[model samples]
Target chain A: LAKTTQPISMDSYEGQEVNITCSHNNIATNDYITWYQQFPSQGPRFIIQGYKTKVTNEVASLFIPADRKSSTLSLPRVSLSDTAVYYCLVGAPHRYGGATNKLIFGTGTLLAVQP
Target chain B: DAGVTQSPTHLIKTRGQQVTLRCSPKSGHDTVSWYQQALGQGPQFIFQYYEEEERQRGNFPDRFSGHQFPNYSSELNVNALLLGDSALYLCASSASWSGPQHFGDGTRLSIL
Candidate 1:
């Protein structure tokens, strides 16, 4: 498993775009970048995931570079409801023998969306 | 469809006591994983159970044990608890080991 680093906090205004970056210098070939959003008193919700290049979903977009050392989660036109802690994790999807892939989480980036 | 569900949203315990937390995986899910989250910190993996067997474990101690039933529901048992054990325990479920995990709100355990 590779260790990840992310910003402790970020600020955004309503209807603005917010980008949170995470760095994983020792990412393995099988590893993928996953971003999760957690609201207060709630479990983390899956946001976006990517291996290399770019991947987009209805909620967010993930951009990975050729090096795969880092990833950026982009949230477009943010709202107050989007204020939450965003976590960046790096891990393989699964191991052999049907063993599950355990998620490794960092302190995460606290996105404070102000009205 | 209902997502992952956990039991006893809040609990209080003292030193050397034992506590059990329950979790029901999402519909059609077979794999369950447990995590512990301290205040202002990221969740840490405890272990994962599949097919009524312990498949993977984290850096947790033997005091932290788990059981998975045939229905894919799971229980997390912690014995001889310490104040440091106080945290929000989260349960996540996935259709398979390769699928994305869905998490429950977690059971908040406070150790005095």
Candidate 2:
């Protein structure tokens, strides 16, 4: 398991771009960076995932450097609904090839999308 | 195509008592993991089950136990509960060992 560190909180206005960075200096070669968004009283929703470089989805984008030590989650055009805690998780492949998805979540970055 | 589902969205129990939380994994998922989340804090992993067996556990005490049924559903049991046990209990299900795990809304347990 790799530990990740992200900002405790970030503030952004609506229609602005918000980037949340996570540092995982000990990330392994088989590890992949994943981001999740959690709203109050709801379960965390998967936003984007990336092994390296950049991966864009319908909702967000994940940017990972070649070192694999850090990654950033970019959310374009933020809205009030985007106000939630964002979690950065480093997924390490297990011996079984990709069947154990156990995750450790630290206090995630609270992105407050203000109006 | 329903996602992961948990029963008894909310529960209340007194100290020294026991409570059981149930979870039905997403279709085709075979692994289930449980987590505890206190107020103003991120979720803490409790344990995980694969192939109907306990595979990994976190820092939770022996009081926190779980079982995975043949159908991939799971039950989280907490005995001798204390007020500190009052938190949201989360259940996540994954298709493989390293892929993304889907989660349920969670069961909010309040220990009195």
Candidate 3:
């Protein structure tokens, strides 16, 4: 598993675009970058995941560079409801066993959305 | 469809006590994993269970144990708990080990 470094906190106004970058300088070849959102008392929700280049979903977009040492989660037209803690995680995709499901979470970046 | 579900949303315990947290995996899911999240910190992996067996574990001590039933539901047990054991324990389940995991709101345990 690789260690991830990211901002402790970020702030953005409503309807603005917010990008949170996470750096995993020692990312492994089998590691994938996954982002999750957590509210005050709820479990973290999967936002987006990507290996390289970019991946987009209805809720967010994940961008990765060729080096794969980092990833950025982009949230477009954010709202007050989007205010939550965003976590970036790295893990190897499962091939045939259940051990690959273990994920290490860091002190994720807390995104505060201003109304 | 119902997602992952956990039990006893909030609990309070004292030192040297034992606590058990329950979890029901999502529909059609077979694998369950447990995590612990302290205040102002990220969730830490505890272990994962599949097919009624312990398949993988993290850096957690032996005091923390788990069991999986035939129905894929699981239970996390912490024995002789200490004050440091207080945290939000999360349960996540996936259709398979290769699938994306879905998490429950977690059981907040406060060990005094």
Candidate 4:
């Protein structure tokens, strides 16, 4: 598993766009970048994932540079409900009979959305 | 339509005591993994279970053990618990080893 580093915290206002970047200098060829959102007292929820370039879903967009050393998760029109810790994970998707697909989480970026 | 479910949403045990936590995977999910999350920290992988066998585990010690049933339900057993073991235990279920995982609310264990 590639070690991921993210900001300890970030602040944004409602209706604004928030981007959290994660750095993984040792990313491998088969590594995939996945992001998760976690609220207080709840398990982290999958937000988006990408291997390279850009992948956008209804909730967020992931941008990966050609070097693949770092990735960014962009949340548009943020709301108060979006306040949570965002995690960046680097690993390969699970293959049958393969190593366990356990996600290694960092301290995560605590995104605080203001009014 | 039910997501992953865990029993005894919260538990309290004394040091050296044993505790058992149960989890029922999300519908159609065959793999279950357990994680330990300490306060103000990220979740740490404990182990993963597939096909009713222990597939892989993290750096946790044997004090942390688990079992996966044929029905895909799972249990985490902790013996000779220490105060350090107090944390939220999360159970995640995935359709395949590599697919997106769904998590349950978790069982909050407090070792007093």
**Interface DockQ of each model:** 0.72, 0.63, 0.67, 0.65
Give the alpha carbon lDDT tens digit for every residue of A1-115 in model 2. 7999999999999999999999999998778888988998878888887899999999998988889999989999999999999999986635463357578898999999888
| CAPRI tier for the interface of model 2 | medium
Model 1's alpha-carbon lDDT is 0.93
- Give the Å shift of residue B6 in candidate 1: 0.2
Could you give me the TM-score of model 3 versus the true structure?
0.96
Structure candidate 4, residue pairs in collision = A94-B98
Root-mean-square deviation per candidate: 1.1, 1.3, 1.3, 1.3
List per-model TM-scores for chain B: 0.97, 0.97, 0.97, 0.97
Stretches of candidate 4 off by over 4 Å are A96-100
Ranking of all predicted structures according to lDDT, beginning with the best and ending with the worst: 1, 4, 3, 2
TM-score of each: 0.96, 0.96, 0.96, 0.96
lDDT of each: 0.93, 0.89, 0.91, 0.92
- Off-target runs (Cα >4 Å) in candidate 1 are none
Q: Residue A42 in model 3: shift from native, Å? A: 1.0
Chain A only, candidate 4, TM-score: 0.95
Query: Model 3: runs farther than 4 Å from truth?
Result: none
Residue A21 miss distance in model 4 (angstroms): 0.6
- Given candidate 2, what's the lDDT at residue B95? 80
DockQ result, candidate 3: 0.67
- Ranked candidates, highest DockQ first: 1, 3, 4, 2
> In angstroms, how far off is A110's CA in candidate 3?
0.5
